[model samples]
Target: MSTTPQRLMLTRTDGSPISALVVDDEAVLAEMVSMALRYEGWTVTTAGDGASAIAAARECRPDIVILDVMLPDLSGLEVLLRLRKLNPALPVLMLTAKDSVEDRIAGLTAGGDDYVTKPFSIEEVVLRLRALLRRAGITTDDGDSQLVVGDLVLDEDSHEVARDGESVTLTSTEFELLRFLMHNPKRVLSKAQILDRVWDYDFGGRSNIVELYISYLRRKIDDGREPMIHTVRGAGYVLKPAR
Candidate 1:
């Protein structure tokens, strides 16, 4: 519920093509990181220090960034703070050698959405980056919505929801999940798929978070009308306009 928009967008290509800045003082590792991102169809730019990273971020305005915490000229945290001032919506993934709980907490508190520790697998890093992007509302498709299913009409850009032509209030998470379901109406989404696509994490992989949120959505979207969201029992949930 306290999630902030990280502002990541995915491209249509099977490759997760994106523009990303990699900031690491170690030239070899910097090049390696850049190459991995490039392998995913991403455009890679490298900066040897925090100062250069900030400058590049301003110039390039990339969709996401990979920042090394131990930069020569400036720390990654400092760079993150300054960069957010420049573009608060910028998505930053911190790279750290420490792997300590304190470091992770600091990075998230200082504005980085996610992090990868030193000597990480290219595949895991890519997955985490994609997860971050998905949570930020980016996907392989480019679709924005402003319409109704049943009596509920939702406007995404405006963060407005209406039932029977009357507006309704919803938490940010609820609103986002509803938008996702509405966009893919009549598609039965399994809980695992929904967890991956919507919540963006495994989250123990057995929690009822999805069911709980769906219940919240039903209350707001179908409290006084024919249910638009239906459970398939052992399968998952689907949103369809009443026939």
Candidate 2:
């Protein structure tokens, strides 16, 4: 069975919906990235060239910009300079088809906050944007910053997890996986879904990684308490409040 990817509904620190500007000469890629950002509950604006990007940045004052290194008019570096002049603190994640280290350095040296090579997964783009947002001090609203299922609690902002009043230590990957499960408590999540959401890429038939992480979570979350994470016969894993 397939399930629609869940919307994160993250917001700006000021409690407003986060906004983003996507600048790519490739119309399809721009729209695809914009759609993913919008799915994350962000207001997104797309520009096909450097000129439109600058104009949009001035008008929208987006919280972040997903910039394409290659633009039809001015180079992405030039656009980055213009954008910095408008809002020096605005976070920018550069997208480049070039995977060369020098190319990456050029983008970073030109004041880009982060960079992702092309042919990337949408999940990777989303994950990188979230990290950039957090670093820029834009994060979930206070009311929506944590997830709770029964005795388990996960703090999105603090990256802390606790169960039954006891704090549980989790690695970054583990935290993300648990957070995904917590978001859809009681619903079965297939390994493919878990891989996409947590790893941000296809694992090429390697599902044991999910199993490994699930076992790690169980040891910490279910050890000496009723289990909350359970696997169905041949379906997937589900999290439920311990009965």
Candidate 3:
């Protein structure tokens, strides 16, 4: 008897699986992007024009969208408008060959969450999708790996974090650092400990990079809230859920 292998899937906060729709006119490029995203474990679908892009999104109920700005049927901006109407909070990553500031502004103004100029690396595309998903308050996990301390929730599978149910965005580095701190909640992590675990490098006791990122995380994760990250003066930092 032959057995079938199971493919891993990413899920959102509500325990539903995450899916993505890739809209591009180039067949080769669309397949390549779909494969890359699927490798990350997201359900991936593709469409070559505006009408089909909208149709696919409606049919699939995707969690995010990757849209190419230049489409054979309609402009990317126009497609975004239609998609936004379908799902106001849908995160869209715009792809374009144009590198002008104006072009980027137009996309952003039209509800695109991010943009990548053409000839870009698929690695970067995947990373951007992760960040987009993070901002959208979604992540991948087996439903058991999600970390919750008070109102703060961090899903290891999705690499997503939310404090007090408010979505917080973090850079790639910042996200890693926050994850490290959250994993050891209420544990006084010395700067050395943090540096080792988060950066994997010995800064020879002379680097303030830890301080910088900690401050960055505080602004995003703690500012205007009952401080969760507390400094121990001479000791280190600790993440406490106390409000």
Candidate 4:
């Protein structure tokens, strides 16, 4: 039961044309979405299938992408996996007709930034796009920049991490999880909360992915050092400066 923070409203003064790519098997739907996005003054591109979506993404390097779950050639999840390997920071919004918790979880696990159900309002889609763009630091009011706690730091812009003057390398998922924890430091975050915030709607509480990744983070940030992330009995996990 993962959910994002909800829609965002942006003013016309945000400036610059945000580039986007839409991948869906439906031509009419794609064109319609493109037109709406264009109306917002964004540069939009379309790909009818997964393979072409990947190709367009590589060539275009869009700031955001709207990926439909069902594609004629490849599943949207498969396309997402490929896209993540190609560009981990690419913000992807997944569109699907299925609204089951399982379906949502699967989409999140595939590396989506947000999820929008089919037959949705165009305004809702625009809002989600704006929210993702804002989170990625492409908005006018705020920027992603770098996040830090004590000696540990997560550089959102450079995708790098360091603590106590030592470099730490983490996988993309690990980095995302750590960043979420750092962003919400000292807040008791349940597995559900972590899943929602870090993985978006597509990750249903399927497996021990969060626990496994927490262990990974501990190894890097806490093992053989002053502990920063701690587990509260029957509660959840918390990250804070070592006491």
Measured by TM-score, the strongest candidate is 2
Best by lDDT: 2
Residue-level lDDT tens digits of model 3 in 1-243: 101112234568776657999999999999999998877667888999999999998999899999999999999999999999999999999999999999999999999999999987675677688777877777744444466766788765577888878889888889878877776777899999888877777788865999999999999988998888989999999887755
Candidate 2 achieves a global lDDT of 0.87
lDDT scores for all predictions?
Answer: 0.78, 0.87, 0.83, 0.80
* Total backbone collisions, model 1: 0
Candidates sorted by TM-score, best first: 2, 3, 4, 1
Per-residue accuracy of model 4 over 134-242 as CA lDDT, tens digit each = 7777765333355667777777656798877789999988988887787677788888878766676535556377888999999998878899889887788988876
What CA RMSD would candidate 1 show? 9.8
Q: Return the clash pairs for model 4, or none.
A: 104-202, 105-202, 105-203, 105-204, 108-202
Rank order by lDDT, top first? Answer: 2, 3, 4, 1
Global lDDT for candidate 1? 0.78
Question: Which ten-residue region of model 4 has the weakest summed lDDT?
Answer: 1-10
lDDT of 1 by residue, 38-86 (tens): 7666788889998898899889887778888998888889999998999
lDDT of 2 by residue, 1-243 (tens): 112222347788777889999999998888889888887788999999999999999999999999999999999999999999999999999999999999899999999999999888786687778878877887853434567888888877678899988999999999989988987888999999999888877779999999999999999999999999999868899998887
What 10-residue stretch in candidate 3 is worst by lDDT? 1-10
Regions of model 2 farther than 4 Å from truth: 1-16, 118-140, 143-145, 156-158, 200-206
Query: Where is model 4 more than 4 Å wrong at Cα?
Result: 1-15, 141-243
What are the RMSD figures for all models against the true structure? 9.8, 4.3, 11.0, 12.2
